[model samples]
Target: MVNIGSLVGAGGPNRGQASYATSKVAIASITTVMAMELADHDIRCNVIHPGAIDTPILAAFADESEDESSERTIDGVGLQIDT
Candidate 1:
């Protein structure tokens, strides 16, 4: 199984999100364990901690200037798993 988490998993900037941070950290640990246990069966597991992504939800909270900027876009690394 693959897990998607936030950059907070890497200790990035965060405020009042101890629970959120803890959960993401747990996901990383679980992914590691799954990868090791499934290796013999040709099964794979991974975790992706994406950086700031300017999605519609984020846009909703963005300032008017940011929302209006045509150049505004999501800047983050994406995960690609080859099975």
Candidate 2:
């Protein structure tokens, strides 16, 4: 089982994103449990945290300045645009 998680799981909470952060934490915990329990069956469970990808949802939550800063930060990290 592959789960999509967030860096927020380790970074903790952000303003107005309590639920989002909590869900990511839960995903990690669930993935861990699934991995342990399914190991006997040779099934693998894992979660991936893709940090700070540019998306419409990101802009919806951030103010103009924050959005610009995020863009710069993501660019600085050399994130590739697949499309």
Candidate 3:
């Protein structure tokens, strides 16, 4: 299983996003548990926490230059998984 999360779920905080953050955190926790429980069956589960990217979705909310978006994307955290 692959799950997509946000950096805010890991530690970062966003004002007025408590619910969104909480849900993502729960997803991370559930992914961990699933990975552990399914290991015996040779199933792998991982979660990805992505930072701001230069996507149309983000463009709709924030007007960022291409350079700025690229910087944020590159500076985002990489993939991580715990066995």
The TM-scores of all predictions, comma-separated, are 0.60, 0.68, 0.63
- What tens-digit string does per-residue lDDT give for candidate 2 at 2-33? 99998877556555568988999999899999
Cα RMSDs, all models: 8.7, 4.5, 8.9
Cα lDDT tens digits, model 3, 1-83, are 89998877676555546898899899889999999999999999999987756566545434432465433533444422121
lDDT for 2 (candidate 1): 78
Model 3 pairs whose backbones collide: none
Decide which is better by TM-score, 1 or 2.
2
Q: Which is the better candidate, 2 or 3, if ranked by lDDT?
A: 2
Evaluate candidate 2 by giving its C-alpha RMSD to the native, one decimal: 4.5
Assess candidate 1 and give its TM-score to the true structure. Answer: 0.60
Q: lDDT (CA) for every model shown?
A: 0.63, 0.73, 0.69
Report the error of model 3 at residue 63, Å: 8.2
The regions of model 3 sitting more than 4 angstroms off are 55-83
Q: Give the TM-score of candidate 2.
A: 0.68
How many clashes does the backbone of model 1 have?
A: 0
